[model samples]
Target: MTLNRRNFLGAGAAVAASLSAPMVLGAGKPRVVVIGGGAGGATAARYIAKGSKGAIDVTLVEPSRTYYTCFFSNLYIGGFRELSSIAHSYGKLASDYGINVVHDWAIGIDRDAKTVSLAGGAKLPYDRLVLSPGIDFVDGAVPGWDVSSQNKMPHAYKAGSQTELLKAQVEAMPEGGTFAMVAPPNPFRCPPGPYERVSMIAHVLKEKNPTAKIIVADPKPKFSKMGLFQEGWANHYDGMIDWIGQDFGGDVVEVNADEMTVSIDGEVTKVDACNVIPAMKAGKICEMASITEGNWAPVIGHTMQSRIDENIHVLGDACAQGDMPKSGFSANSQAKVAAMAIRGALTGSKVFPAKFSNTCWSLIDTDDGVKVGATYEATDEKIAKVDGFISQTGESGDLRKQTFEESVGWYAGITSDMFG
Candidate 1:
């Protein structure tokens, strides 16, 4: 039988149970502080509070009141989903699970005293800290691109207003105009995100302005799900997209936001809209906490505990876990493992072996969907991939449509899991 949303969720029940086992606290309640309210942080916060049954005090620090997921924002750009559909509120996490939701910036970390300093002049003490702060762009990763220039050439990588801005820019483009994208380097958040964004942009253009063209200047030789994306692009929107790899001088690129032009290996081309997805590093809070070794924080595979500091566990795109792509699904899976281990350490709950899984689905046209996924197990050294699968080229249209529907179900399920 074909996989549908209902059965898929039923199958996940056992997995969820293994990760979230309630604990009975003995005496002094342990305090857990979670920074960042995105995929990993929010899930970690929810599991800890729900599993501990008020035995552990869970406080979540996030700057944004409404969290816009970066996962399906591309679908919004393609006119497949509403902006309100992808935006989530923290009220559910607070009211339903009794998590202490603090909407403030975490400015400093006092590791010696085990306290986190807030921008509002309050210090939160944590017995165990879970940091899932996500990603921040590296300075000068793309020359002539910076935070100040984001308004002119929106990255739209973080979702929210940036996503809105990018969509508006694409819609306002003149007929037969150019949409240029500067893809990021390796080990970035959402391995297939940039290509998916390209597909969405192409979808929009195919409807609004058929003559428009997409130019992708990628730094890497190949990208995630390359064969599927290329095949879909050919079959769905042929001759509308041009993907330039590193061998063709796509690696070395410079942009002039003021001039509305990009220089790729000394060749210049003017564009109506541009998206510069710069290289990413662990969020600044990780650096502030002194947990980051280089661009990412190193964590033990079984528990996601920071190698730099045992009391702190890093999750999601910010962590340097082996073989896991920096997708929201990976973060959410890792969050469950960390939550289980934290409960075990603090409340003396039973700790189970870490098992993780992730599936990334991208829509080419309306029902033309492609995916890649894997199941993983934690070894002593790294999170190792045990089994994997990908959508084969030239699959039946019915399978692709089912895959698309499955993705829709997954979005609903995972968002509910994370926010609630």
Candidate 2:
């Protein structure tokens, strides 16, 4: 299915009523606690509250009061958007939907007791818990780089101050200086994100520092939309990007934040600005809950329920669900499925088969856009891809513009769906 604003919203709407389980009996309204306020959590919180019609008590625990979306932060870096444009508030979710939006870090989870411990010294009890805490870097994933070094070699993957810092560093680079990127391995959040960042940075340097160069050391030999991104780089910023893939020692890399240098295959190069996106794992809270298998939490695609614990559902970049890319659209899609299941489990609302879809849009340069996406269905085994689409290499300029326009509309629609 082609993912537009209309279909995207329609896809999430509940379908024909099916038999529901007996309504969960509890002392008060069945409590639902959602951790993390990104694409998945926010959407799940809103959907549950709205569909339950106050039958469920929903409390969302997120550390930040203002959430900055990772989806369009690249455009912000490229000057296509302002920083404020990507920042969102939970006020609407609180006021309109009546979700208890708690601005506190989720420090621990007691699955046996069905409670979430917050850093602010509060214990939130839940009948069902939604964990959508997004991704966290694996310790020692990149040699010589750690969270402590983030200030010097900003990962900027979290999309807030780090993003701003990386942009400032790029703007502060000397004329003809070199910018380097240590791209993450596969199964990371947003498969095309690193390449898009490269494009956005290239867009910035093309205007301010035309002579500036970019070097990307990628662990993978190829990436999502590789052909299209390569085409765009050649057309818009030719001779400006040097991509070193695994065959070319891109996998054998290390960084020295103190020295501001990158070492690939024993060859060291001083860099004026460096963006190091490391290997990722499920957010720490998943591990704390003891639900992770290796780096991610495994889930049943039908309900997004944890394989280890049925009462807990994992969503977004944190889950080891099959086929779907870890993206904002993917998370939002999964959230609707999870929300519907939760509603059925808690309030005896009619449930339907889980249908998921995702579209990832990348802006190559001004008015030059490309995308790839697919529709998915939950099977007994995993979430399997049904069909998919991608932008053609030689497509007309007008179609590319249309694709970009579609992405802009999606951004507006999804955010509203999430926060409101």
Candidate 3:
């Protein structure tokens, strides 16, 4: 599906090529520029590239040469999966799917010009733009955890860079040291992520240093996959995890970096390592495009199109689509819906109602895991959940295991659809 640089005839030059070769030539294909080649952006590019069959010019803009997924990042701490194992490249998306992959950062979006400005001073114009740049940090949300002091205690939410930073801190810890985790407030990416991360680190501690301990300062009393996670921690992990719920002085009021002390309810505590999962907001690109509301972008749930501007689409963690958690699986699923909607909007074809799904898997022990899932249908006012899509509280052992396997299958299917 690829064409070489020398053969990339200008947009106006396409008429001659189309006149010579009717079936295989692209004359006036609608241009689509996607920012952020993570799960949502990559999936959107692949789907649009293949579905349009040379009828759409697709260009993906991302700064990273390779993407390390947030999924299974805990495995890195547990010594199960290396950072390289989860790193994804966009070569296939460019070569196999006919997408023009630009390794650059998108600095600004010119809504009036219908173009994206790159840091290299290049401007890419598009008939339609699909933005899926994911989330970014909101400064001052957590005092003392902003740009500078984060070097001392890193929030590994974005994966890649943060993953390495957190890993180094853990590796350099003194023997039998204490590791403290400060989880974000509700409705953050991967609801059970911090808990699972601590679990994995605890797993490493149990094996390497028995005297080591893990402290959890959770903002919420209950978490995703709560029952299974607590049971596993108590039964198999020797109850090594010390959890302080929101009511029990677990809410972090402030942090002093030099002292390495976190104040919870004005009570200070010291730690050998600290992981503070800060609050999140939509990527700044969305805000630049004037599509975000508060922490996320408001999109028509049925089409994944922006409520403010119909020509632009937003998905993944950046979007505030209801009933679906900010997750990789959800992003991949929404990409297909957004792709179809964009294709239809371009070709004057039928646009079907969108259906969204997401399931997050958390591995408690080496052999045990749990999951939570949901499906939703969009309405005029908002997206509503379809019945029977969440993890059951009273399900049996075999049922939970089935759900665990389902998450693996989903990751495979979604990535295949994205880069295959």
**In model 2, what is the error at residue 298, expressed in angstroms?**
0.2
Backbone clashes counted, model 3: 0
- Give the range where candidate 3 is weakest over 10 consecutive residues by summed lDDT: 1-10
Q: List where candidate 1 sits over 4 angstroms from the true fold.
A: 1-27
Spell out the clash pairs found in candidate 3.
none
Q: Mind sharing the TM-score for model 3? A: 0.90
Worst 10-residue stretch by lDDT in candidate 2? Answer: 16-25
Candidate 2 C-alpha lDDT tens digits along 158-207: 98999999999999999999999999998899999999999999999999
Cα TM-score of candidate 1: 0.93
Candidate 2 local lDDT, residue 39: 99
lDDT of each candidate versus the true structure: 0.92, 0.93, 0.80
Q: For candidate 3, give the lDDT of residue 108.
A: 92
Give lDDT: candidate 3, residue 234.
Answer: 85
TM-score of each: 0.93, 0.94, 0.90
lDDT of 1 by residue, 145-241 (tens): 9999999999999999999999999999999999999999998999999999999999999999999999999999999999999999998889999
Each prediction's RMSD to truth? 9.4, 8.1, 4.4
Point out where model 3 deviates above 4 Å.
1-27, 389-406
N/CA/C clash count, model 2 = 0
